[model samples]
Target chain A: MTYCIGLRLNHGLVFMSDTRTSAGVDNFATSKKMFTWSVPGERMITLMTAGNLATTQAVISLLEERSKTLEERDPSILREGTMFQVARLVGATLREVIDETTNEGQLKQDQFSASIIVGGQIKGGKPTVFLVYPQGNFIEITQDTPFFQIGETKYGKPILVRAYDPDMSFADAIKLLLVSFDSTVKSNLSVGLPFDFQVYEADSFAMGTTRRIDENDKIYQAISEGWGDALKDAFQHLPSYKL
Target chain B: MTYCIGLRLNHGLVFMSDTRTSAGVDNFATSKKMFTWSVPGERMITLMTAGNLATTQAVISLLEERSKTLEERDPSILREGTMFQVARLVGATLREVIDETTNEGQLKQDQFSASIIVGGQIKGGKPTVFLVYPQGNFIEITQDTPFFQIGETKYGKPILVRAYDPDMSFADAIKLLLVSFDSTVKSNLSVGLPFDFQVYEADSFAMGTTRRIDENDKIYQAISEGWGDALKDAFQHLPSYKL
Candidate 1:
């Protein structure tokens, strides 16, 4: 299980992913899920994946391999001209990799499953966010749904549904995202800390911010404590039935 | 889809459930998910159901029917001597009803498809809570896992995970339950307005307090709005990313 969120806001795009993977409860390990491909000012695409570790790793390896062999890879994401085209490229790569590995007659037979959040800007296009489904098909974020989340999403979904807005200030967006993540982490053992996050200013045409939030991070701590306190205070104010 | 939670606090027990059922996004209707079987001072039991409305309704009907039969029958929940006996009776009823309905049919069926939270106390026994699984087997709320939730539980699980404590005041417990319900209502279309809730006092052995919260309820509205604002304010107080 994983929790990754990609937000498309007026000020910028925010990408956050937890770094935890496991085959089972006792077999847990931390693995960074966020992958970024950048050609400096030309294009910067970020991918955060969730699902079967082997399948996710296979997909990432294939994409990274494509990035390295651009000449041989005709429709590579690195060479894509628009953000949409890049999504197509990523989807195609996902489909190809899932097919190659999960198809029958393979030594390690398993279900093909992986979902990715692709968010970035091409030199000539505006920054966009897309949620690629396990089937390799994708949906772009719209004004109504300005964010995309994949993996163990329910516990954290309420905050995003209630608070997210297309015109929300970047600060508010990030805070909401953190609270959302905090909710998920508290409930799920599969999603663990040392979060990977990046913020891209809408028209900056460059990566706006990137950092890893650990257990001791001040902001993360504040969000955790504040949310707990707010919930307690909120609970106190509700009308109680007089017994 | 539905969301129902049962909490076993030191002072008493709390049960809450939403009242919405849906086959899909297009087909939705309001259905009460909470039920009470009270003999006032002798015993007061509240049952909340979630999952497979047909199955839940069947179980409720059976329970209600049994309540009527207590006058004519030798053994029934109302006539039961102990809370444990009452729990056993409910479990046996659930098992019998599910097996009879699902086993005798040729229809494509979901096995033991409804989950229930049964909480109350007989006059002689201490207040108790049980989470009855679809299979008719059940688990008592313990000090370690003092609360049980069924139906669309994940959304409301986080607040409890962080804030619940054995010594938590009844006031705090009810507040927590409401906020948790609020989170669930916000996230899932399957869980909706008009919540039914009851709080039982430990030694009172009766339906101590109960309320039906609707969209127009002022206190609920305040908690919802205050929580959102407090979250934003808390977020503002946190230090921003330096980058």
Candidate 2:
């Protein structure tokens, strides 16, 4: 299980992902799920994956392996003219990986599958975010669902649903995301810390800010403590039933 | 879709449920998911259901029908010897109803399903809560996972994960639950307003507090607004990365 969020806001884009993966409760491991293909000032494409670690890693490897080829590498995440095309390339690669793996009778019942959050901008396009489904298709983050979450998404959805807005400040977006993640971690042991987060300023054409929030991070500590206190206070203030 | 929660606290128990049910985006209707069996001062039991309205209604009908025969029945919510027995009765009844309605020919992948939260106490028993699965088996809420949620649970889980404690006051438990419900209603269209809630005081052997919260309810509005603002405030306070 994993929890990854990509938010598109007036200020910019924020992507956060946890780094824990497990086939089951007893067989847990830590693996980084966020991969960046950045040409620095030219284009920056970030991909966060959830589901089937082997499958996701295989998809990433296949894409990287293809980009090294001469003919098949034209629409790479680094070479694509638009973020949409880059998403397509990633989707296509994911489909190809699943087909190859499954055709060999190595996987069963959608076990060799993955979902990716692909977000970035090329040299001439606006910043965009997309939730790439397991079947090699994708949906963009619209105004109504200004955010897209993948992997263990339900546990953190309420906060995003209530707090996310297209016009939110970047700072507020990050905090809401942290709280959302905190909620998920508490409820589910499958997702855990050292999260990778990247914030991009609108039209910056570069990664605006990237930080790794670890278990001992100060900001997270504050958010955790502050959120708990705030909730207790909020609960106390609600009107009780007249009994 | 629905959102129902049951909490077992040292002081008492809390149960809350939303009133919305939907077959799809277009076929939505409101039905109360909560039912109570109280013999004034002898025993008080609250049951909340989620999943497959037809199945849930069937289970409730069976329970109610059985309650009618309590004078001659061996095990009923009203006639059970202990809270544990009451839970077992509910689970066994759910199983029987499910089996009666479903057979091999009628089985689909998602057929014959409902989960219930049963909470309260008999005269000599302490407060207790159980999460009854669709299989007609159940698990009691413990200090570790002191709360049980059924249906549309993910959207409301963040708040509960952060705020729930075995030792929380009854008033605090109710407030926390409302906040959790508020979060769910904000996110999922399937779970909506006009909620039924009950809070039982330990040892009272009767319903302590019960109310219906609607769209325009003042406290509901307060928690909604207060939580939204608090989340934004907390988000804004987080330190941004220096890039």
Candidate 3:
């Protein structure tokens, strides 16, 4: 299980993901889910994955290798002209990796199935976010749906739906993502601390901000505690039913 | 789809459920999802149902018939000596309905499957809550797991986990439930307005308080507005990330 969110704002894009992976309740490990590829001022692409670690790692390795070679895969993340093209490239690579794993009997199709959130700034296109399904299909963020949440999504979705603003500052967007992640980590065992986050300002074609939030980060601690206290206070003041 | 919750607390029990039922996004109707039965001073049982409306209605009709007859079904809900017995009776009736529907070529087992939450007070026993599965198995709420949520529960769970207290007052419990329902209602189209809520005091063995919260109820409106405002204020005050 994992929780990753990508937000498409008017000014920039925000991406966040948890790092915990579990084969079962007893076997737990930490692995970064957020990956970034950039050609300096030309294009910067960020991808966050959720589901089987093996499938995601294999897909990432394949993409990295092809981008370096530029032989069979002509349109790599590095060379894609638009964000949509980058999404298509990632989706194709993921589909190929899943097909290979299924044919090898390494895992069932559903067992190794994974979803990815692709968000980036292409040299000529605006910053955008896309949610890539396990079946190699994807959809872009729209005005009605400005953010995409991939795994363990429901527990943290209400806040995002309620508080999201298209013109929110990068700092505010990061704060929103942290609050959303905090809600998920508290309720779900599979999603935990050490969340990776990134921000990309539109037209910059480079990563604007990046941070890894751990369990004991002072600001994260303050936000978590503050939100809990505020909720209790809000509850105390709610109008009670007249009996 | 539906959303219902049953909470067991040190002082009493709380049950709340929405009233909307839909087949796909087109066919929608309002129906009661909460039911109550009591022997006045001996016992009082409250039930909330979610899932196939036909199955829940049939199960409820069967229980009502048996309680009135009291001959063939000796341990009817009306005559159950313990809260557990009442839960068992409801579970068995629900299972029988599901099985009968399955045998009649009406629908598949999973298609008509339902879940129920039972909470009550018996003359000689403490107030308790039970979550009844479609297979006729049930689990009682304990100190570690003091609540049960059925159908469309995930969106509303984080707040309950963060704010629930075993010793909170009856009014506080009702407020908490309303908040949970509010969150679910905002995020989901299946659960809607006109929620039924009940409160039972410990060892009283009779219905304590009951209310149907509608779209225009004054207290319900106040709570909803207050909670939304409070959440926005909290969001505004959260410290922004420094990059």
Among the numbered candidates, top TM-score falls to 3
Give TM-scores of the second chain, every candidate: 0.89, 0.91, 0.92
Better of 2 and 3 by DockQ: 3
Which CAPRI tier for candidate 2?
A: acceptable
Per residue, candidate 1 scores C-alpha lDDT tens digits across A78-163 of: 78789888788778877777777665765332455788899999887888999987667899988888888999998998778766
Model 1 TM-score is 0.89
Interface RMSD after interface superposition, each candidate:
2.6, 2.6, 1.2
Error of 1 at A140 (Å): 0.8
Q: Write the per-residue lDDT of candidate 2 for residues A179-226, one digit (tens) a residue.
A: 889889988899999898888887677776788889898878888777
lDDT of 2 at B90: 88
lDDT of 2 by residue, B1-243 (tens): 789998888788888999998888999988999999887778999999988888889788777775566676543567778878988888888878777778866652255678899988888778889999877778998778888899888877777777777787766677788888888787778999899888888878777778898999887787788777766555555554433
Considering DockQ, where higher is better, how would the candidates rank from best to worst?
3, 2, 1
Worst 10 residues of 3 chain B by lDDT: B66-75
Error of 2 at A92 (Å): 1.6
Candidate 1 collision pairs: none
Candidate 1 segments whose C-alpha is farther than 4 A from its true place: A66-75, A100-111, A165-173, A234-243, B66-75, B103-112, B165-172
Native contacts retained by candidate 1: 0.46
